[model samples]
Target: MVLTLVRYIREKGMKPGDKLPSIRTFATELGVSQSQVRSGCLRAAAMGVLKIVPRSGCYLADVTLSGIIGPFTLLFEAMYMNVQPPLIDLYELKTTLERGIAKRVAVIRTIEDLAELKRLLDAMETATEHAEMVRLDELFHEKLASSTRNPLFFSLMQVIHSMLRQSRLSYKDFVSEFPQSRKDHRALYEALRDQDALKAGDIAEQHSNRRKLLLVKNY
Candidate 1:
């Protein structure tokens, strides 16, 4: 049912935040019971694909197809077009890449890289919204990747972030840990500033572990 609704949405070219059709109308058109349509909408909302308001009905989430699917949306044409890689699988890849990339970046990062990261840290401190917080967090990691001077790792980081975005936002732990998260980021920055590769990698691993634990529990 979620796929059916998504198909209907894509066909109509609905924009983010656009109101979804009424459950009765959807049931009539999609040839499903209203209860079934409601159940599907609820599941989609849980998956972060739609927003359900008590008084306002359902609406499309602010997620794009490319963002919801993966960053490699335009990168290739694969046979499993309808399949999205498992969220845990993507998170595992991200965790692995970040650990190694953090070490390399610490050893090779330049003053310019530090400056950009510092700026992002400052912005993150002032960000109050969950969406903005997530955006800044992703940017902070992206900078770390770019600082490594390795285009492959940098591109992979982008893909990982894009694909895992919804997963990141689904958990309240992502926003609730803001203060501690800042300290984590600062620790990594300090490690980079001191060119301590081991320390940077350790911090990255610890950070990923915390998120991984929370992700598994929540998911």
Candidate 2:
């Protein structure tokens, strides 16, 4: 159903903020029951594909990493509550994925990508509030993933970041390592700028290990 809606949007060339057909109209057009259309729309909303506005109408959401990972955000929340192993496993998975992403990003990243990464890095270094720093940190990683030019990598990183955000408050102590993290990001960015995939991978491993240590100490 979500795929159906996404296809519909694509076929219609609807941009973000473009109004969607009313539920009844969509149902009739799609030859589905109104209930099914509503369900599909709600699911798409959960996945960040559609926005539902009360007293208004549904619209296409901006195609963003956050929106793409919205359903995973909900899934990770449930896993965090009901399953312990999955949370740990998710960290391991992210570690493996990001190392590869870092290497690929290094080889493929554009000048514009480096500029955005540097911008985020600067924001992180100067951020006085813990929350703002954390937000910038997430954005920095997201930008790195985007530099890889792999939509799957970007989407997965978005999900992992969202899941980590669920427990960020409890891990405030990790913010104490912000200075070191900033240095690591700078090194990683330089490695990427140099287009040295091997160096990028090594930096990624070091960065991931440091983060794992922080999680171990804090958790």
Candidate 3:
């Protein structure tokens, strides 16, 4: 039901914050019971795809190409696959992506890109909460991917970051080394600032491997 509602919203060309049709309208057009439509709306809202207001109608949540990746991944797992990708597989793919991002971003990054990355790192320094630290770290790498001026790269990194977030929650012993990670981010930022492609690539790989070790060791 949730998937059906999602498809209906997409088919209607609805965007984030746009109001969906009335439940009665949806039920009549979709040939579903009103109760089903209500349930579907509730389910979709739970998935972060819809926003239900007490007095107003359901609205689409903030939409992004990256935001849809999580749903697609789960749909694939439930419909076509038996299990999620192993941690090692996710690490390998992310490491490769980071290596490539470092190589290109070092050469392609503009002054503005560097500044944004530096800004994220500076925020990391002042961040007091664990969740804030993790969110900033995600944005840091997302900036690296975006600095490459490749939409594909940025979208892929977002999905990987999402998956890694879930993985982190599952690994009870996978404590974060935010301090060391921040230092690595500083080095990466410097490498990009210097336009040192080779050094940036190396540091990116090393950083990925360090996390890989921590994850597996704790697993």
Candidate 4:
């Protein structure tokens, strides 16, 4: 049941804020009980895919960049493909989430959280290879999401980040050859350490958008 709507959304490339069919309508279309469709809708809403407005019909929620990753990943895997469009879409989503998270982190990060971020950077430095770098990178974002003290934030981030990681091979070569990105990461860490929210957010968004542009240009 949950899988059905998820697959439908992925197939349709349904953007955030699109309206979904009503429970009765969808169930009739699927030849299932309305209760089943309603239950599925509830689950999808919980997963941040759909929103049920009290006075209005159900509509797609403004899902975070991280939230759409899982479906993108599934789309990639199922089709045995990674394409430019999904990559660009995912990057845009990450840009949105990172900026928002940066604002919160600027205000909310604790000393311990900053220390942990440094520790993640240290692990990233020691990773010493692409596979290890990817692993450490995931940990870094996951840890950042935790520092925000918002579970929903982390949940969306994990999905979005995971999507990017899974499709990274599509653009890894272009990104890997850039010497400046390594330096940028360090600079980003320093900004976070200082709790410089605006700087950090700007840097994060720029970093994501740059990659998206590069990927589009080269791949």
TM-scores of the models, in the order given: 0.63, 0.65, 0.63, 0.62
lDDT of each: 0.82, 0.81, 0.83, 0.73
Following a full C-alpha superposition, what root-mean-square deviation does model 3 have from the true structure?
7.4
lDDT of 3 by residue, 91-171 (tens): 898899999999999998898998899899989889876667768888999989988887778777877777678666566
Write model 1 residue lDDT over 164-202, tens digit each, in one string: 677778877777888888999999999999999999999
Candidate 2, residues 69-174, lDDT tens digits: the string is 6565555455556544344566777778878988899878888999999899878877887788778888888888877777767777877777677566468776
After TM-score superposition, the amount by which residue 107's alpha carbon in candidate 2 deviates from its true location, in angstroms, is 0.9
TM-score of 1: 0.63
Question: Which regions of candidate 2 are displaced past 4 Å?
Answer: 1-87
Question: lDDT, candidate 3, residue 104?
Answer: 96
Candidate 4 lDDT trough over 10 residues, lowest sum = 76-85
- Worst-scoring 10-residue span by lDDT in model 2: 78-87
Runs in model 4 lying further than 4 Å from the true structure: 1-85, 170-175
On TM-score, the candidate that comes out on top is 2
Q: Please provide the root mean square deviation of candidate 2 (C-alpha atoms, Å).
A: 7.0
Query: Which RMSD values do the candidates have, in order?
Result: 12.4, 7.0, 7.4, 8.6
Model 1: number of backbone collisions: 0
* Lowest lDDT 10-residue stretch of candidate 3: 73-82
Return the lDDT, model 3, position 154.
77
